[model samples]
Target: MIDGALAPLRILHLEDSDLDAELIEAELENLEHPVVIERVMTRDAFAAAAVADRYDLILADYVLPTFDGVSALGIARAQCPDIPFVFCSGTLGEDLAVEALKNGATDYITKQRLDRMTRTVVRALAEARARADKRAAEAALQALNQTLEARIAERTRELAEANAALQAQIVERERAEEALRLAQRLEAVGQLTSGVAHDFNNLLTVIAGNIEFLERAVLDERSKRRLAMMRGAAARGASLTAQLLAFSRRQRLDPSPVSLNTTVASMRDLLQSSIGGAVRIETMLQPDLWPARVDATQIELVILNLAINARDAMAVGGRLIIETANVAVAAPPTRPERPSPGEYVMISVSDTGTGMPPEVLARVFEPFFTTKEVGKGSGLGLAQVYGFVKQSGGGIRIDTVPGEGTSIKVYLPRDETEADGDDVKPEPVDCAVRHPPGSTPVLLVVDDDAEVREVTATRLVETGYDVREAGSGLQALAFLEADPCIDLIVIDFAMPGMNGAEAATEIRRRWPALPVLFVTGFADTGALAQAGVVGADGIVQKPFRDGELERKVARMLSARQAPGLRLVADRGRRS
Candidate 1:
């Protein structure tokens, strides 16, 4: 590309039909940039031109009498991987196009959609240029570093102390840069995993909701058994998705002030049984340890995962020490993911086992990245621990030496707002819905996903509430403005246009006394907190157990103290 005018591009076209080749050339010529297409009709010609790397792009037909586009793509990738490869064929199907993309084709198009070729070609070339720019920038960085080191070495005789100080600074900067790179990579992976998990959660909600309805209608012993199995399978799927979300730091967590010393002490017998007779487990508890506000169950799981990982590393018997203490971090350690300087409750898990090398350490926090043999690990062990700690306002650091041992330290922010009864958790009391003892509470369910909205609305309806449906936040608002008899709202967090939080803000402005219960598959907690939605009274995660939503809704509505919220009770409930 040129600033004033588009530069001419050299394109290699592989098509058996002369007419099709001419059409391809015509579409490409229509581009703002000039194009010089070298057309090839035979296997020999195509292979020779592809390996030459003399073209900016390659366009090929999927099928040919003696040659194929896939083979041409392979040759191009092997010889000149930088060149963008696209397939334009009359016989190309959707599945084949997907396969071609998976096999490294830049883009795929059918003859019927040839108009898309020009746009695709333009975008592909731009992306290739971007990739080239990134490579050049990285190369420049390396060159600069090399030049600095060489100059420092040359000046060592005259400036020995200065050289030594500069060398340490250089080493520290390099470590920080490496850590930043790793953090960026893991963050990108977390984003993709969270999106996929959100979709899976929505699907699971539908399946589980329908199954709950079916379980009520069918009571045959054999049928009941099959349904139970299916429900269990659904639960397993939800658990897998939850683990993925946990790795992404997007899973809903219930945090409380808990003592890690007590947690570890309780898990002692379980840890012994889990690790078997191979690894010797020990715990060192700090007497006056400050309580950390974290999800107790998740922390337990994190400890167990660390224990199991240690056990796996030590094929033969080894020592696994779990220690906890209060520490004031002066500064964050040189790690990609680190905690801020603050008071923290630190837990160290040290193992005398086969330690990880640099390559394994780099990807230790990535979801589903494991060095163990296939069937032995799901690779989510460290990822879950990493995400949980990070999400709980904490940091984790790993110290390992090959052939020596490994130690992982987790730093959780000390809970400063602990009250007297914070340690005592209340047992669940069955919430029997009784709104003013004589009226049904009207609830509005808002969601962008139709099936999810239906499932949620149905559940609320079955649970003895009068439920209304809205496909979006705007619609929900409209319903509320028209119907003041509505007592509470159950809204999805993620939506197009105005989201649930935005609507909730507007709803609060108009109806301050009406409470909201958020129903969500996945939520970006930071964003919600910024929007002031995280502190809202109620939230029920998606794929929730049978009674979870009901309990939350019942409690919220009951707290409103009447059949309808606020002024609505004064106006009387609608029939």
Candidate 2:
């Protein structure tokens, strides 16, 4: 309510009798704070004046000539909704006045109660203003609540969108991590295969050379026949070793954008020779097929391996079909394994052979899991195919039934660029034919393996080197301390007490100008740098060729005289 000290009450008096209006005006004038009263006799006059200016209170007579007090109260309510309306009637009874108060009238005054008129008007006006202020406060509070709800809803939507994006990023990261782990596992298998292949190649070289020497020495027919069998077995072992290296992905790869049509056309003769004259080979290559990114030689190997498997499946003659086509994976496949979606060039090999059951098909790509007889297959063919396709960022699928034929599909990623024009062919090098000269220098062979040391020393001596052998780092150090003129030190990396790297360190510390060569079967060699052998004179992988050993020794000895510090020469040799 507005304090009476700040604002005076504005009263509208509606009555037909001029005397009654004057009486109410005089009653209000007697108050300490003056009230402003505007008198209107007709309803038309009341409404016109109320539209121009509103009142804080309404005083109406019960009976007017043209209208009644009830009609005047309505006019006041329409113009100023919260104003107090009171009735002052000469003929209105106590019951009728009570009825008016129930119908929105604040209070009523009879003609007999002239003294109570002023106090009733003041109290009625104060109460009406209090109700008005409360309604205003409630409206403002409701508006503020609506605004807060809107803000919270908007923030909730933003959080939902952010959560969805975070989930997508997590999925992509997990996929990349899985692919990296698979690659590392393949690399570990490759390391093991490389070690095995190196040792097998060296053994084959010895056995084959010795067999040829015995053939020249032996004259009996039975001895020659047994020697021929041994040579044949050694050759087969060498072939199996090569396949293992290929399946483990250890063989060197030279990748290029290759046309499937051209590669298949060139391999017609070789495939015929390998598969024999029984199976009929057919090719259905798309003329405008997209090129694939892969090593051509490895792809050839994959084709041959698949053809051989097809031949084995069909003991009798059967038709083999090789088809090439372009494919696009627009969405993830509906398999449990979610393969990536992209463009690919698919090469499918289908054969009308004795098909495999589900059991055989499931284990076809596992290494050494073969269906052939014990001595007939090495079981690395399909494993090599799997490794090749996976390494090229692609996938493979196989379909087979018990009685129906079998089909294997290899998907290779498509390259957008055209094949290069040069496309120079690579020349094959025969390592056995290129033997080093038999004039070996003074040599020091160091190995923790007693057998390896003895064999290497014997071979070097036969090639005309004054050979010395050491079975440990301490033994090599002792030998070096006694004879400083030893030409080269071939040290093994894995020794029992002092390793080859430590032995090389001690040798260099004593004789700064000494030449040291490391021979290791292990893949990682960075440890040599940390052991103070910062620059090695040379590094030959273990089970090396006679040519490799001889060439490395000659190169290191010749580099020592090239007018620089021996350490500098070592650095140049390593580079």
Candidate 3:
């Protein structure tokens, strides 16, 4: 199928001269694979087209009748971003082209030097398409294998069920064996995805945020339009990072005790709509299954992800079965990779579809491992399921073979006394009253990033607060000392000279009544608490919403005036 092939390269050309466009089109036509070209003579035309969809490469002339290459470059960037852009001009100076490259153009090619133009275009397109194809294939294979494994496991279970009492022990033994194998697979996959997800997510956050910021700064109307394409690419990168984080189990989750039957029943309509009318989804809940502690939303995400994978695996049609049961693990199963014995709630998903080989199975949970074509799958679905289960103190098992179906079983630790289940509800906290609207209360904004500090300070000033800015913890303390009237201090945790904790300690010592809010990207909650910044009045993680920051600051300031609010810093320092 064409879907299995690398995505075709799409090129957009912005040149005032029709000859230049024709030349580029001719060059691309001679490439090995099919090349799609879209041409635009004016900056306005290019801007309008760039936002329609992503292009593999953009070729812009350095000079246009109404606009220059730089202006066109900006428009192309705004509308179809991150795709490589090359300035092809006969009259553009070498120095200017170099400057354009520095300003974010992928490459600058002179018309006389069009010899390498075809090669550059072909190479870039090939790389992009190859990546897209590889990703798609990995997703397809993972889905196929998962479906196959589910069916095989179900068949094995059924055969074991037929023997009744004698086979019961054997079935239990096999289940344990299966779990051990899954654990090993998960551990290996988890280690790899976790590291990649962590680093990749950090980078994505920066890239995506900055790209959006740049999009807003584009001056020309046409250039501004091109930012949308860049934004889309950034958004895709963000989504991929999110998948990686979920698979790595580094994603923040809200866990609760939930009944599989109830949750699935509620989501039936949504699931049915998602899978379409072609594929069948069946639910088989045990008469009295135990409630399991898990993130209900995440569990739903896992189920949906698995079901979508199943649907894809069965290109023609297939049955997807979701079942639940209870088991007691008295001792760790005999399987070499199994967990310690305990009560467990098992949720199994099975499907009948094209299966996978042993080689694919081994790397199934690796991030970016997919069978679908490039740009189709991020290859983090099962890896996410594995990470979620392991992080929540559970286990997962899978069994399958090529051409056969597949079954995946997730085993969560069971609470014996609450086996019958009690009403589970999320309690809502009445968020403290909106910060009393008043003068921005003498706000101090501290951040290592100059841009963040400036923006935040401007925002605060706009809110009517007399804002002071500091680039580091030491600088903040110096500012505070010189101006003791600073009513609120918003500090970034990671800073040179002195960290937020140390600065907070010093601030508290001199100005006991001062309210401090620490912002950080670090995930170590223990470290924050140990530094006497526990509870609602302390630290706020980075990437915070404007309202969250405002509210936290307001609440902390309000708490300072409360007679019973305990000052922990002084007590801790004394102890």
lDDT of each: 0.80, 0.72, 0.70
Backbone Cα, N, C clashes tallied per candidate: 0, 0, 44
For model 1, the superposed segments whose C-alpha errors exceed 4 Å read 1-158, 216-226, 417-575
**lDDT string, candidate 1, 1-575, tens digits:** 22225667888988889888878777776676777888898888987887655888899999999988888888888889999998999999989999999999999889887889878888888888899899999999999999998988778765987878899999999998987888888999999999999999999999999999999999799999999999999998998898899989997899876777667766777998999977877656654467788888989999999999988888788999888888888976778566788888998889999899988988898888999998999888888888899999999989999987899999987877642325433232112232444567779998988899988988889989888877667556545544545678899999887788877776676566677888887887765664456553577888877799999888887777634224421110111
User: Model 3: per-residue lDDT, tens digit, 40-98?
Assistant: 87756777777735676788888878878888777766766657778889987978988
TM-score (all chains, Cα) for each model: 0.44, 0.44, 0.40
Query: Which ten residues in a row are the worst by lDDT in model 1?
Result: 566-575
Q: List the residue pairs that clash in candidate 1.
A: none
Cα lDDT tens digits, model 2, 1-575, are 23556476677888888787777777777565757778888889988876523677888898888899887777776776577888988988888888787777888988667788867876887788678788888887888788888888889989999999999889877766765665565566667876888899899999999999999999999999999999999999988787766666566677777766566655667877888889887666553466788888888888888888887887787888877778887876432122359888888888888899867865676667898999898777887787667667777767777666788888887765532334333232222233233334567898878798887777678767788776667556545433445557777888766688877776676555667878787724666875444344467777786577767776787776422212211100111
Kindly state the number of residue pairs that clash in model 2.
0
Model 1 quality (TM-score): 0.44
Compare the candidates by TM-score and give the number of the best one: 1
Judged by lDDT, which candidate is best? 1
Residue 341 lDDT, candidate 3, scale 0-100: 76
Question: Which stretches of model 3 miss by more than 4 angstroms?
Answer: 1-192, 219-221, 330-340, 415-417, 420-575
Candidate 2 deviation (Cα RMSD): 23.3
The window of 10 residues in a row where model 2 has the poorest summed lDDT is 566-575
